[model samples]
Target chain A: MRTLLFLLQKEFLQIFRDKNLLRQILMAPIIQLMILPWAANYEVKNISLAIVDHDHSTYSQKLESKIFSSGYFKLADYCASFNDGYKLIEGDKADIVMEIPANFEKNLVRENKQKIFLAVNAINGVKALVGTGYLGNILNDYNGELRLQWVQPSKISPIPSIEITSMNWFNPGLNYKIFMVPGILVFLVTMLGSMMCALNIVREKEIGTIEQINVTPIKKHHFILGKLIPFWVIGIFVFTIGLTISRFVYGIIPVGSIGVLYVFLSIYMLAVLGLGLLISTYSDTQQQAMSLSFFFIMIFNLLSGLYTSVDSMPGWAQIITDLNPLRYFIEVMRMVVLKGSGFHDIQHQLIFVIIFAIVFNGWAILNYRKTT
Target chain B: MVAVQLNNLSKKYDKGKIVAVDSISFSVDKGELFGLIGPDGAGKTSIFRMLTTLLLPDGGSAVVDGYDAVKDYKAIRGRVGYMPGKFSLYQDLTVEENLNFFATVFGTTIRENYELVKDIYVQIEPFKTRRAGKLSGGMKQKLALCCALIHKPSVLFLDEPTTGVDAVSRKEFWEMLKRLKQQGITILVSTPYMDEATICDRIALIQSGKILSIDTPDAIVRSYEGSLFAIKSEGMYKLLNDLRSYENTLSCFAFGEYHHIAFRDKMKNYSEELLKYLENKGHKEVEMMPVIPTIEDCFIKLLKN
Candidate 1:
């Protein structure tokens, strides 16, 4: 225990002595948390639209006005020819184009039918898909209005329609920040915890200080714990700062008990720090450790359900997420923060994280030897 | 009692492709100052590492302070202090903090064993607050030594501690080692400098993972088989080539300002004959004389045989 205290003291002294590292540790995460959630927003908006009206008829003008008033699109150009509207899309100035036929009003009035063409830029597939869906809904609404005007009131038959009233239970306003802030805070904490722990041990190897430590009477587990605890404390500190920022800067507060969140967080940090120690044991230099940690963190970030829902992934990929600690972290963050879940709800995730802590730390302690 | 013992200990790298330390055996008695003298890549560091329990031996067994190096490594770790070839102290730490850390790690306070490192620590105590990375090469070496000694281990291993230090500092370091020896600490040190070999009570001259010879410095020098001569001419480079071409030259190597050469056959007045031959080859200032062989000369002669 005395050895561990000395080791922890030395580690903390070194950490606090390097002013630049201290700044990076405290500042980088805050800056990333403050900015990344906004940039990572997936909501598509401001779709530029171009329209061509060869008909010059009252009904065509009405359709154009209805599409513009829907507020999901902005008019980029109003052209007299279809070819001119095509030119706008080809020049990348418009995301979608709508062209009306010359006899649109005559067909709708006499034959009760008309044909309209939409040319959508498919380069950005998501924008094109959502924009076309919005325009389709508006055209359908306009068609219903036209049918009502043409037909007289008969009061002989009844029409049936279905409406969807979606109540987003956790986030009523559907605010992206509320959903994203907690997940991003988890990611920031994981990155800081894993990278710093890995780099700290590998730095000792690079500078040859580990050799001195190995020749002493210090137990392998004690040294591993000494390395783990300081960064664990730092991870908690960074997480708290991130939470304060989320509460004030983004107006986010956990609906559940903060104490439950910390219980999971403490276990989560042990797993991550243990992973970092394992990487350091296999690597002889800091460069190798950073690259190895980066490879794992990248996989964790992509598959953690931070940006995409895990259910939507392919079957094989979902199985892989079971091995990802970040997946559990993000899930629990959303559950506790948005769903107001208690410890009983996140208990399964807590078990996996505990197993990870035990497996990784046990393997690290076994691999670290005083005599090789 | 044996402080350190090796019996055909060996180590290899890259799946047994590169042999680092061959089958070698030696021992250091309690309270003795033992040196492993050789140039770089001579396996001095490898031997030190294996004995210090930092590396595993491939073939045989090693015992330190009466504990098996392979099986009882934990007991040996508590009884040994190792200063690796490279400066291994934490550079980001202040000198005093580093010392205190090592002391606490060994479960002792500096106050408990202050006398063990006092002589060496006092020299660095004034700069206790300075970060170790900011210190000079000599100061860094001193700090490493002090940290190694803070635990007062029965056996101390110093691997090339004075390799990059200045001349004055190196002299002072040897003096400190002498003082440590008087305190009855069994010290095992390695050095590439031949002059430093004389300071050891006994040394094993190693090369290519093999021990060439092991004896007292005086015994090794007195054991040289043939007459050795230090010869120089006006043009040292040309003189070296000319001396090598001489039919009787057994071994010729540049040693500082002159060349130390040995002949295959012992003969009287060979210096006169050699000098006369050099003058005939258009050499102006030819000088040759018989001299006693130093440890380096003995090492080279042993390597040649």
Candidate 2:
């Protein structure tokens, strides 16, 4: 234990001495948290729409006005013919086009039915999909209004319909920042924990200080703990900074117990730091350790369910996410911050992370060689 | 009692494609200063690394401070202090911090073993606050030696400690080693410079992973069995070629200002005949004298055989 204290002291002294590394650690979280949540938004907007109205009828104008007022789209062109609108779509100036056939009001009033065509540029798939969905909803509402107006009170017959209403429980407004901040915070902490610790030991190796360390009487666990504790502290410091930014800058407050969140974060740090140390043990140089770290962190970040819902992934992919440490942290962060979940709700995730902590740390300790 | 021992130990690199330390055996008695003398790539560092438990031996065994190297590695590591050929101290750390760190990890305090490193550490103590990387090469070496000695292990393994140091610093380093030996610390130092061999109490002349001879420096030089002479002349380069072509010349190599040559057979008036031959070859102001063999001369003679 005394030996561990001395080792920790040396590590901290070195860390503090390196000004560039100190700046990187303290500033990375603040800068990334402030910028990433806003840029990585999934809510698509500003879709460009082209209008081709053959009939200058009031109803056609009303539909055109309705689409323009929806806030999700901007008018790219107002063309007189379908071909003119089609040209806007082909030129990539418009994301969608709406065409109303000639005599549209005549058919609607005489036959009580009308048809309209919508052309979506499917090249930008998300914009096309969401834009078409929005247009469909507007046309349905317009049709319902027409029906209500055309029916007289005496001739109206009862018709049955099912209307579905969804209440977004956690994020009622569906603010992308609210949904993304907690996950991004978790990712930032994981990155700081793993990459920094991975490079620490390998730097000693490259500088040849590790040989001096290896020849000493120090126990393997003491050495590993000495390395693990300092980075774990740095990881938590970065986590706190990220959380503060989310709360003050984004107005996000965790509804769950702060104690529960900290407990999970502490355990999660061990798992990540252990993984970093494991990489450090297998590598001979800092460059090799960094590349290996990049490989794993990349895979973990993508499969972490931060950007995409884990449930929506294919079965094989979902199974792979079960092994990712980041996936659990992101889930727990959201559950605690957004869902107001307590320790009881996160027990399963906590247990899995504890297992990861054990497996990774134990494997690292076993692989660390005092003599080879 | 033996402080360090190796019996038929061997190490191979690249899956046996290169033999770093062929099967060899030697030992250093307790409190004796031993030297492994050889040029670079002659397996001096390999021997030190294996003894310090930093490397595993491919064949046979090594015992350090009464503990088996492979099986009791943990025990060996505690008792041995190694200074690798490369300076292995933390460059980013100040000298005092580096020393304190090594002391603490060895379960000892600087005050506890202060006496052991006092002579060496005091030399570098004035610059303790400066970071090690900023120190001059000689100061860096002194600090490294102090860190290794902070724990005051029973056996000290220093590999090429004076290889790149200045002449004055090298002389001081050897003096410090002499002082440490007086304190009854068994020191095993390796060097590529043949002149440094005389400082060791005993040395093993190693070449190509094999021991050419192992003895006291004086005894090794006394074992030379040929008439050796130092010869000098105008046109030193041409003199070397002319002497090698002579019928009686067995070996010729440049040694500083003069060339040292050995004769296969020395008859009466052979020196006068050799002088006449060199003059006929357009050599001027030639000088020749029989000289005593040094360790280098003995080494070359042994290598020739």
DockQ of each: 0.88, 0.82
| Highest TM-score scorer | 1
What is the Å distance of residue A349 in model 1 from its true position? 1.6
Assign candidate 2 its CAPRI class. high
Error of 2 at A4 (Å): 1.4
Model 1 clash pairs are: none
Q: Write the per-residue lDDT of candidate 1 for residues A281-334, one digit (tens) a residue.
A: 889899999999999999999999999999999999999999999999899999
Residue A45 in candidate 2, Cα distance off native in Å: 0.8
- Give the residue spans of candidate 1 off by over 4 A: A150-157, B267-269
Residue B152: error of model 2 in Å? 1.9
What is the C-alpha local distance difference test score of candidate 1?
0.91
Per-prediction TM-score to the true structure, in the order listed: 0.97, 0.95
Residue A288 displacement (Å), model 2: 0.8
**lDDT tens digits, residues B36-145, model 2?**
99878999988888998889999989999999999999998888889987888999999999998999899998999999999998898999999999999999999989
User: Per-residue lDDT of A226-276 in model 2, one digit per residue for the tens?
Assistant: 899999999988888888999899999999888899999999999999999
